[model samples]
Target chain A: MWARTEEILPYALLLPSLVFLALLILIPMVQALLLAIQADSGEFTTAYLQRMAVDVNFNDAWRNTLLLIVLIVPLQIVLALAMALLVNSRFKGHQWFLYVYAIPLAISDLAAGILWLAVFTERGYLNTAAQGLGIVDQAKVYLSFENFGGLVAAIVIAESWRATAIVMVILVAGLQLIPRDFFEAADLFGANRLRRTLYVVLPLLRPSLQSALIIRTIFAFQTFAVVLALAGRNMPVIAAEAYSWYANNRDAHLAASYALLLLGLTIVFTFVYLRVLGLREAEVKR
Target chain B: MAGIRMQGIVKTFGKTTAIKEISLEVKDGEFLVLLGPSGCGKTTLLRCIAGLETVDAGRIFIGDRDVTDLPPRHRNIAMVFQSYAVFPHMTVRSNIGFGLRMKRVPKPQLERRVQEGAALLALEPFLDRYPAQLSGGQRQRVAVARALVMDAPVLLMDEPLSNLDALLRLQARADLKRLHREVKRTTVYVTHDQVEAMSMGDRIAVMREGVIEQCEPPMQLYTNPASQFVGGFIGSPPMNFLRGRTKAGAFEGEGFSLPMDGSRVEDGRELLLGIRAEQIRFGERGVPARVQVVEPLGATALVTVLVGKVPVKVDAPVNTTVRPDQNVSLAFEPADIRWMDATTGAALAH
Candidate 1:
């Protein structure tokens, strides 16, 4: 009887989570698929998907989404790697630096967007500082629709600032896992600071970097609140368009179609990241 | 091809002084081992010599060149870490060749040197495999191979065998000693294992509380320890220390009195007597003791006897019949006993 209970215990313990997945995720996903591929009469149709394809914001939203990911992911990786290396150095006041750097990780995305909006506004501190520094004659609008580059730059800066902390924290944990003896051995082998980072630290940080890239890339595809708060209708992302379709146009089917496209892109890129940066099981264990 | 000389080396971490003014010299091509318990500043002193730790006050010379202000990369040295810091991502061949590659030794020369190191360490078959695919011993060999490939004049090893199991440790220890002899470089090895120090080092420096208690050849250190700490630390099962006061020409303890060297200590003065476990002989005429435990170790047996409140061990042949709670008599030659200061724990000579 004890052996029988043991055999069934795993399945019994997994039952609640399975039920929750089916109710909350699997069912909703299937419903969204149906809504994307069927009409109101419950007959199969491509009308909603076609409408999504020809939507005015579709191309721009995806283009902007790809641009954000291409620009922000690499920038965040570099910044986070630098931050992690600095914190691991145990410089004076390193504990305070760690706490200060991770403060943004606790900040909500919407709150961060609102906070940056306050900074990049026409009379915000940035322009005020520019004016004070005599780089500009007066406080000028930087987040205006006419200045597309400026708007994208502001969004990139805001997102990079708000999210690099998390990547840095992950990399810091990975760095700590590596034995200090490795660095000392490298030094004894006559590796300079640059060589040590390139040959030892970076190669060893693959697992953490890969995870950070995948997570940040997926989040980049779904950028909405930050975009909406900063650029509103002036700049569009795939998630923002999905929201616009559901809330403004009252078309849940079209919204689900957009959401499916975003999901497809995220899945594709996640696979790319896994294929490019993934380590074998043995490598990670080692 | 060079020796190391450190004069008045000191290192401190914040308020805690890790290494108190240490002066040591390692002759060229000699294998010198720093043997001590954990946190005794052995590793710190080695790191200072490696240029990995900055000395608070001292001068370090590697073959007449002062390296006290230089960084580790400029020290012209190689080191093997206890964790076997072989790069997990690189093949054994690449790991061994890394230092050469950094020095920009042309590819052909680099490959030849790496091959030589691999052959020396018996790692030929595992060259193409990454460190993850190798066993613990093989990984440690890869670390050694990396250090050897550099062809540096000096090598530093920090407890490199403490991670291995007993059998592997013995095997690795023998390999390290053989390799040191073959290379004939000035080597500084740090470990807490006295057996490794005794078997491998040309000279062993026994340390305690950030100071060297005694530095001498292994046999000399074993025979003539400068302090009670070295005597206690350098021997297996440790040296038995009996605390008592000198009365007439004998040292008196709780339940026994042993004849002492007449001029060794002054009468009516407190003193301590140190004797090796193996030095004591079991016979019918000697100090009285009651056997408490007997441990059989292959060819030999260790018998623990209670003399008053003190426990003394006597090594006997395995064939001897000794059991727990048996009455026994133990004795040692007067020349075998070491007299030490009771208050200071320093060895005293007549």
Candidate 2:
């Protein structure tokens, strides 16, 4: 009896979910901003901003996060690409392999970091196995704080194992979407395997690559749990700095300042990613 | 360009055979089309010749070499797929030039070949554009251009025009015919459309269930189809089949009797009598019938008539006095009769 559009009354239905998001997501974000700028001094000065500029600890945190992004994202992309290509082939038990590779996607970063700890600790699996095999005469002194490269390596491996599956899944979908007709046509045209991959597969897969890279960059920029779990307080990341500024020193003002800096960095990185991908070129209409 | 010849080629997928012990030879510079209905393995046979699919048994020769196990690249056979497999990332220039690039042809030679292929397909204006930017017809031309630049001995197509709209299909067909005329390359084309098979092929192979029923010139395929399947599959408003019994020298059906050719008859045996819709005239001594439907095609009318219980169609001039439910005497001349074994469905000689 009533018009369908008029009968449903959509605003009432959408009101509850919007209210929940506003409380849970938006409010906390606003609180973090307020706390970052709160200036622990009685008078609001530029002290928190000065801490970001002159503090060696804050600079170390900045350097470490960038170093991880530089080292981790490209490695994840390459590993994921290789996995996707190997899994894409007509191999038996591909389904089981896919599940095995994808299992880390659901595992938390904290869990993965702890799992790697079992390998890297001084009396851990690596040294124990090396001693058992007679490769080492004594227990190897591993997990030393002085080893910066080891710390970076631990964090890189943790991030790669946990995050590479996303890129693989994206590439796998891209691979499937390529019509088999193209490969047959390429073969008829005398294209070898390498030629086909370059001339046929890579070109068609550009969009998938673009999206996968963007997502991985976003995830890498925010990497926290794995660094903390593996390297502990000795390793300084952006998020760990923010937590220490707020909780340990009881300086919410400096924490929010650090949070704002990380936010700015994230936005800048996203814009750069979007530009690098040339996202609009591949989508030109037929 | 070399002539393609296949001798006793056989291929099977799992337990089912897609192409049986078949043999065909395409002459140098001939446009040959393979025609059949869906699941008839015309495409499968084309792939076998292209070296994209390997035959389970038998040899394939391109001019003088046995190339049964050769990879498609080594065979140098180019194919236009029903879906044009244009590379999505590359510009039209690179896509057409890809075959040359793979051969490690000289830079100048590659550019010259790409230029020539682009000009042939009228793809010069869009050379900088990727396949995603081209129209369907343009993509098809690029696909053909991709094949052409190879300069391979054989150009094989697997229902390349099936994806186009009816109007584009007609244009593409005419273009294909013209292209073949100019190049005079030995080509193997496959389609289910009989008109395409008829208009394009110098020799047509009519197939059914993985076996070629008949291989001959298009006119022979239309006029003297070697099997009941070929007869039924070829013509547009296809051949009309009627069940009849031979007694003495006469063939008796439901509504009327036709005098049998003694050479065609097995005495006192039941058989199928086939007549093309165009073969039987309207105003002749055929069979008495009532007009059930008259479909007015441009210059001719397909008149569907019911004689006793059997439905029959006759092609007559557009201005025939046939109306639904009207009675008329339709005639069948002895010359129009093709006798077939009703049980086996094989054509019997008259």
Chain A, model 1: TM: 0.93
lDDT of 1 by residue, B8-127 (tens): 999999999988999999999999999999999999999999988999999999998999999988888999987889998788998999999888899999999999999999999988
Name every residue pair that clashes in candidate 2: A36-A256, B285-B331, B286-B330, B286-B331, B286-B332, B287-B330
CA error at residue A140 for candidate 2, angstroms: 2.6
Tens digits of per-residue lDDT for model 2, B1-350:
78988999999999999998889999988898999999999999999998889999989999898899899999978888888888776788988988888889999999998999999889999999988888889999999998888888889998989988899999999998999998888999999999999999999999888888899999988877787788889988787888888888887888678776666566778888888888777665567788999999999999999878888889989998878998888766677777787887888876
Residues A1-286, model 2: lDDT tens digits:
4677676768768889989999998999987776656654545566677877776688788899999999998898889878887888759988787889999999998899898888888888888999999999887655668988888888898899999998999999988988888778778788887777777777677778888887887788778888888888888888888788788988777778888888888888877867866535644765
In model 1, which regions exceed 4 Å deviation?
A1-24, A105-111, A121-125, A138-141, A281-286, B253-261, B290-298, B318-329
Error of 1 at B160 (Å): 1.3
Estimate the TM-score of every prediction: 0.91, 0.94
Clashing pairs in 1: none
